[model samples]
Target: MYRKYFKRLIDIILSGMGLIVLSWLFLILIIAIKVTSPGPILFKQKRIGKDRQNFQIYKFRSMRIDTPDVPTHLLENPDQWITSIGKILRKSSLDELPQLINIFKGDMSIIGPRPALWSQNNLADERDKYGANTILPGLTGLAQISGRDELSILTKSKLDGKYVENITFLGDFKLFFGTFVSVLSADGVAEGANKKNSNEKK
Candidate 1:
């Protein structure tokens, strides 16, 4: 019941309210990104979603237009492509605020597995093995709170599987708020590369 109905209901209510309340912040980020970088304010890319569906995930642009379309985790020197403001946004995770729109659009939920990139075939295949790709992708999830950029892809996929098995109304709410707490403390964000790369995709 929760997965099929209540989840989307809550997502609509919360995401709609979030966008309304954060309208001012959205405008600020838009202008800030525009002035700091010479590119589109929003980054969009093909990400594998529920049931192996492909969708464009939206995020605030924090990289230069010339930045390569590769995961920051694999980049040799991600800092070179990041703008000054992008650094703060990446650390603070303000770079993800634009994803509220994705939640509202039904391409994502407030909490679930983070969408893997289409190029991340290995990760996607792992998710399939764990049955983690059977539901909508999310803005945050167990893997995100567990270790985020620090977790190995295999471990992250395992956590996503665990989250799927444990999905519930109350459980989702807890994880949703836990993500905010993680962000506040700047915990489990980065490992080898800058944390902002997670949202800088596309």
Candidate 2:
């Protein structure tokens, strides 16, 4: 009942409420990005979503215009591509604010598996094995709270599959609350002790 009907209902209500509440921040990020970077304020990239559907995920542009469209965890020198403002935005995770629009549009949920970029292959095999494409991707999930950039795709996929097996209204609530704390602490910025290349294994 919840998955089929109530989940979407909750998504709509919460996403609408979030947009209304965060309107000022959204405007501020837009202006800040424009002032700091000479390019689009929003970054859009193809990501794998439910059933392997491709959608352009939106985020506040946190890198310089010249930065490659590379995943943060894979960057050889992640700091090199970040603008001065981008560093703070990325650290504070304020850059993810644009995903509220994704939630509003039904491209993402507030809670679920964090969507993976199409170029990522570290966990592609496991993602397929876990059947993670069966459901909508999310802005945050168990894997995100558990490790964010620190966890490999295989680890994340495992957590994602676990969430899919036991999704519930209460579970989402817990994951959402946990994500807030994780973001505040800026946890999962790097995986393990590696501090880099969490997206690809050696």
Candidate 3:
């Protein structure tokens, strides 16, 4: 009952409140990003959402307009494309704040697996096999706080499946708090994106 109803209700309420409360911060970052980088303020990319559907996940633009379509791990020099402000935004996870819109739009939730990149066929397939794709993607999740970019795609898929099996108000609370701690500590955020998944093409 909670998964089908209350969860989405919570998503809408919290995300709506969050946008209202964070509007000032959003404006500030908008100005900062524009001044520091010559490009759009929001970076939109296709990601696999619930049921293998595609949706545009949003982030504050942290890279150059001409940044390649590949994941950061695939980029030969991700840092070169990152702007001066992007560095701070990424380190602070401010780059992801815009995803509150995704949650509000019903494309994501406050807790679930991070949406897979559109090109992440292996990740999506693994999640689908485990039925993890049945749930909305999230702003943060168990795997995110546990290891973020450190864990392998398969490992992440397993953890994501586990989360689906164990979804509960308490579990979600734990993940939410854990994510807060992780963000504050900047834990598990692989800046160089060195982790490799088998599905990635060289």
Candidate 4:
């Protein structure tokens, strides 16, 4: 019942509120990216969502316009493509603020497995085997708190599956609160794990 009904209601309310509350930051970053980068202020990339559906995920443009389409870890030199403002946006996680729109559109929840880029075939394949898309993807999740950019795709998908098995209003609330602390502490990067090549290429 929680998964089918009230969860959608909660997603609508919280995501709606978040969009309104974060509007100012959104506007500011939109302008900042325009001033700092040569590309569009917003970056839209196809991501795998619930039921293996494809949706375009929104994010602030943080890399150079001509940045190659490569896995972040495989970028020969990621730092080189990041604009000055992009660095700050990434560090503060403001780059993800745009995903609230994704929430409003029902492509994502406030909490679930971070959506996998469509290009991340290996991760998506693993998720398919585990039925990870039975639940909507999220801006953050158990794997995110456990190890954002640090954990392997397999490990992340496992955590995501765990969340799907036992989702609740209370659990989501707790994840929301924990996410605040995690982001504030700049815990996006995994600790004691290799930041690069976290996803093994299949």
- Highest-TM-score candidate: 3
TM-score of 2: 0.91
Worst 10 residues of 3 by lDDT: 193-202
Cα misplacement distance, residue 134 of candidate 3 (Å): 0.5
Q: Write the per-residue lDDT of candidate 2 for residues 28-99, one digit (tens) a residue.
A: 878888887788888888887888788988888878777655566556676767777777887788878888
How much is 187 displaced in model 1, in angstroms?
1.8
Q: Local error of candidate 1 at 91, Å?
A: 1.1
| Deviation of model 1 at 182, angstroms | 1.1
Report the C-alpha lDDT of model 4 over 36-153, residue by residue, as the tens digit.
7677888888888888889988888888888777656676567787789988987787888888889988999988988887777888788777778888999888987887877777
- Candidate 2's C-alpha runs over 4 A off are 191-202
What C-alpha lDDT do the candidate models reach, one value each? 0.83, 0.78, 0.86, 0.79
Ranking by TM-score: 3, 1, 4, 2
* CA lDDT, candidate 4, residue 68: 72
Q: Sorted by lDDT, highest first, which candidate order results?
A: 3, 1, 4, 2
* The 10-residue segment with the lowest total lDDT in model 4: 193-202
What shift in Å separates residue 188 of candidate 3 from its native position after superposition?
Answer: 1.5
- lDDT per residue (tens digit) for residues 1-202 in model 3: 8887888999999999999999999999999999987879998888899999999888999888888767777776678988999989888889999999999999999999998888888899999878899999999998888878888888999999999999888899899989989999988776444545422111
Error of 4 at 68 (Å): 1.3
Better lDDT candidate (1, 3) = 3
Candidate 3, residue 6: lDDT = 89
Clash counts for the predictions, in order: 0, 1, 0, 0
**TM-score, predicted candidate 1 vs. hidden true structure:** 0.92
RMSD of 2: 3.0
